[model samples]
Target: MKEHLKHDLEQINHLLDIIKKQGVEYLKLIGARPTSVNHIPLWETQNLPESGYGTEETLKIFNQRFEPIMVGSSGPRYLGFVTGGTTPASVAGDWLTSIYDQNTQSTIGQGDISANIELETIHLILELLGLPDSFLGGFVTGATMSNFTCLGVARQWVGKEQGKDIAKEGISGLIKILTATPHSSSIKSLSLLGLGSNNIVKVKTAEGEREAICIRDLEDQMIKLNGEPFILISSGGTVNTVDFDDFMEIKKLKEQYNFWWHIDAAFGGFAACSETHSHLVKGWEYADSITVDCHKWLNVPYESAVFLIKEQYKILQVETFQNSNAPYLGDPLENFGYLNFLPENSRRLKALPAWFSLMAYGREGYKNIINQNISLANQFGQLLERSNDFKLLAPVRLNTVCFTLKDSEKQDEVGRFLETLNDTGKVFMTPTFYNGHSGIRAAFVNWMTGENDIQLIFETMNEVITQLK
Candidate 1:
């Protein structure tokens, strides 16, 4: 045995205690940590030693090399890119996930029940979102992968409509996809699936400063398809202003059309927890597939999201992702393994963090998180509204505020303003372009964010603008 390995095993408890203490200190000081930092020079890579260093020494080296530049992307004032902070319960589950290191590939006859736990966690998520049992869901790394999985199945279903198996035989001819203001991740998914992103028929958004789909334009595009089967990718909440497509109208169209409907709910799906905002997603339950991100509004750790597809399309999903040649893995239909349902052959117990979070904070608890974040967002938006130096690009639709310089002629200054604001290390926001004008977007998804944080951000923004002037 390696000397370092033996030493690590013997002192595992002490090693873990050190890690626990480090984690506690980081979490305790997260709010005060810098949200952005200037680039630090990388540590020179070293050749492998003849004998490995002991675990404690190795950790010390890592801390010295990398810990200083670790930014506070998960902290309260990180209002950038719809980032969410980890909950205490989620951190607990994440730690256990690494310790156990279980491969969550099957629910039965696999000598592990972690997959069963994942299935139950999916059920709990559906219940929380007020979705019907008709939908079956599985966890993936993030919204991008979730979108890929759903659209992969959609591609197969489109092929099936023409009596072809695209998964086995490869993409055949043009597969039409229609969307208005789809996220970049969805376009990336199309490219990954061999469905050309340029092939998407860009539907028109609603009039004025809206990002929502224009129902009339969508209907016109459907007519142009001339009865050919297609896929419609809709947004539950857009990233910048959190604009939601009219799901009720889309549901009506689904009854008359033969196209598959998919919704990229991502962070916005949490609106179901708000009685005041729940109406925004009234008919999303009817979607053929839905993507939701646990790392965003759910306040779980990074790389956690779920893709929910209708139970009726289980066979299609299997066709899209089944490991057909592996006889030892058993029949996908009869035995029922998640390995045959989604992407990736080997997966961690990715559902654990989400399960712990949902269990620790029930429906009411999530409701509070969602509502509180929304309130904070509106509070920030109100500040932007009253500020003489800034102007809102759109109303606070959900949990994001899109604003820009009060003078449209100073549009070129948006990036500079954002850079200065982010450099403050007091708050972080991302630059955006909206309605032909450059803008800055502050998304409120972190659970620790409150009125105090908003006020701090507001004051900081004013100070930065004054400096810029």
Candidate 2:
């Protein structure tokens, strides 16, 4: 080993001690961290050094070059992109995930307990979401891959309906997919799955500011298929306004239609945590497959999401992802390994942070987080409605506030407004185009967000509007 590597090995405990202290201080000051900063990229970059920098020197170099630009996207005031702040337990677990660094694969026969721990995490999530044991789940990097995994199995099911093994035979026939306002990630998944993004038959959305699927129009689109099998991608919570489809009605349609049902619940599935909002996800448990993001609403670290497919589809899932060529791995059916279940063959113990979080918080803790976030969103929404300078784009449906400038002629100024507001380093939001008007979205999923934070957000907005004029 190099001298630097030798030194690193000798001082591992000292290095970790420094890291632990720094992490604690950072967490302590997380609320004070700037939500935005003026970061100009250096077009010029550096080449690799022949000799390694010691750990201490490297940390200093990183701090000088990159640490100042670090935005508090995980902080309470960060209202962009439905981001969630990590809890104490989750941060602790995340640190240990790197410390252990186990290759999580199998459960029983593989001689590793990591996969079993992952399985248990899935069970906990299912119970928290009021779902059933009939669903089998595993962790993926994020919602994009989670959608890819669930849709991969859905693709296999479609092929099986036509009496062909898609994983073996390849795409020889067209697959029908019907959806209204499907998330962009799902469309990306279709392209990745060899199903053309153009192949999706657009179903009409429900009336009046809702991104939910129109049940009657959905049935009409299904009628065009003439009893042929298709896939129905429904929304649990829309990205813009957090509108949810009528899952109960869709459950009824599933009984009559031959289509596979998939819900991209993502952050919205946490609705089950609130008695008032849980009805939004009613009948979601009956979905053939579901995608829930842990990083967004579960307040875990990044690169964590779970894809749940009904247990009955285990055969198709295995056929789609089975490692058939590797003989030493043994029969895929006999072993029941995770490697043959999802998109990635190799994975970390990604479930540990989520497991730690669930175990620490339990159902009641998450319930409080969900309900509190929803309430704070409403508080912010009312402020926007009362403000003379802003307009409410949609009702504060769940934990997101979709709005725009009140004056329609100021549409072009919206982008600059958001830029200036974010530059304040007090709060952050994302831009959107909704109902033919440019809009801004402020999503609240962070556990630390409170009524005072909502008031701070409005005050910041008011100042920005006044300065812009």
Candidate 3:
């Protein structure tokens, strides 16, 4: 055995204590940590060592080389990429996930029954989102994988409609995808699924800087399809302005049309937790498949998201992802194995963090998180609109605020302004372009953010703006 490996195995508790202490300290001081750090300089490091440095020495090396560069992306003011912080219970669950290290495949096999925990977690998630039992879900790495798995099933359904087994016989026939303002992840999934990314037929968005699909235009596009079966990729929340499609109207159209309805509700699906904002996703339960990101609004760790596809499509999902050739693995149809249901054949017990978080904080607990984030988002949006230097690109719809400079002629400075502001290290935001104007989006999904954080964000913005002038 390697010297370091044996040492690590024997001193596991000591190593764990050191790690726990480090993590706790970071969390304790996260509010004060810089949201953005100069990452380029941190790239300097030695190549792989000839001999192992042992766990303790290796951890010391890591602390010296990488720990200082670690930014507080999970802190209160990290507004980039619709990020969210981890809950205390979720962190505990994630640690156990590595410790237990179950392969998380089948419920009935001789292997660990961690899959049962995953199943229960799925049920808990459905309850949290007010979804019906009709949807059978599984954990995937993130929204990208979740989207891929869902659309893979949708592809099979599409093939079934045309009387062809695409998985067995290869992709054939045109699988038309109709959508307005679909997320980049879904488009990437189309490319990965062998469906051309450019194959989508774009429907018109709703008027007035809205990224949501115009229901009238959507129906018109469907009418042009002439009763042919197709796939409709609808946005539950657009990344730029956080716009949601008219799910109720889409449900009405489902009555007359023959198509697979997929909703990429990634972060916005948490709206179901808030009574005031739940109307944004009124009819999403009718969707054939929905993608929800746990790391975002659910405040779990990375590589965690769920794809909720209706139970009626189980056969299609199995046909799309089944590992039937492995005779030793048993019949895919008989066992309740996630291997035959989702994308990856072998996966971790990815549901633990979600299960722990959901259990620790019930519906009311999550409700507070969602509603609080939304309220903070509105407050931040108001700060932008009231400022002479910043102007909102859209109304604060959900938990994201999209805005740009108040000076239209300074549009060219948007990127530099954002870069400079991020360099300040107090707060961070992402840049976007909306309605022909460059914009900045300050997403409010972190649980730690409060009224004080909003003031700090605004103050940072003003300082940056003044520097640019």
Task: Quote the positional error of residue 35 for candidate 2 in Å.
Answer: 1.3
lDDT of 1 by residue, 1-469 (tens): 3878888899999999999999999999999999998666667888887777888988898898888989999999998889999999999999999999988977778487688889899999999999998998898999999999999999999999989989888987999999999999999999999999988999999998799999999999999999899999999999888999999999999998889999999999999999999999999999999999999999999999999999888888988898774423434546768888998988889999999999999999999999999998888888878889999999999999999999878888889989999998999889898988999899999889888888888889889899988
Q: Against the true structure, whose lDDT is highest?
A: 1
lDDT of each: 0.91, 0.91, 0.91
Each prediction's total of clashing residue pairs, residues at least 3 apart in sequence or on different chains, is: 0, 0, 0
lDDT of 2 by residue, 1-469 (tens): 2999999999999988987887788778877889988676674576887897989788888878887788888889999988999999999899899989978988766356578889899999999999999999999999999999999999999999999989888998799899998999999999999988888999998988678899999999998899999988999999998989999999899988999999999999999999999989989988999999999999999999999999888888888887774323435436667888987877899999999999999999999999999999988888888889999998998999999999999999999999999999999999999999999999999999988888888998999999999
Give the range where candidate 2 is weakest over 10 consecutive residues by summed lDDT.
325-334
Question: Which regions of candidate 3 deviate over 4 angstroms?
Answer: 42-45, 326-334
Candidate 2 residue-wise lDDT at 258: 98
Better of 1 and 3 by lDDT: 1
Q: Compute the lDDT of residue 449 as modeled in candidate 2.
A: 90
Residue pairs clashing in model 1 are none
Candidate 2 lDDT for residue 387: 89
The true-versus-predicted C-alpha distance at residue 325 of model 2, in Å, is: 3.9
Question: Which lDDT value does model 3 have at 59?
Answer: 90
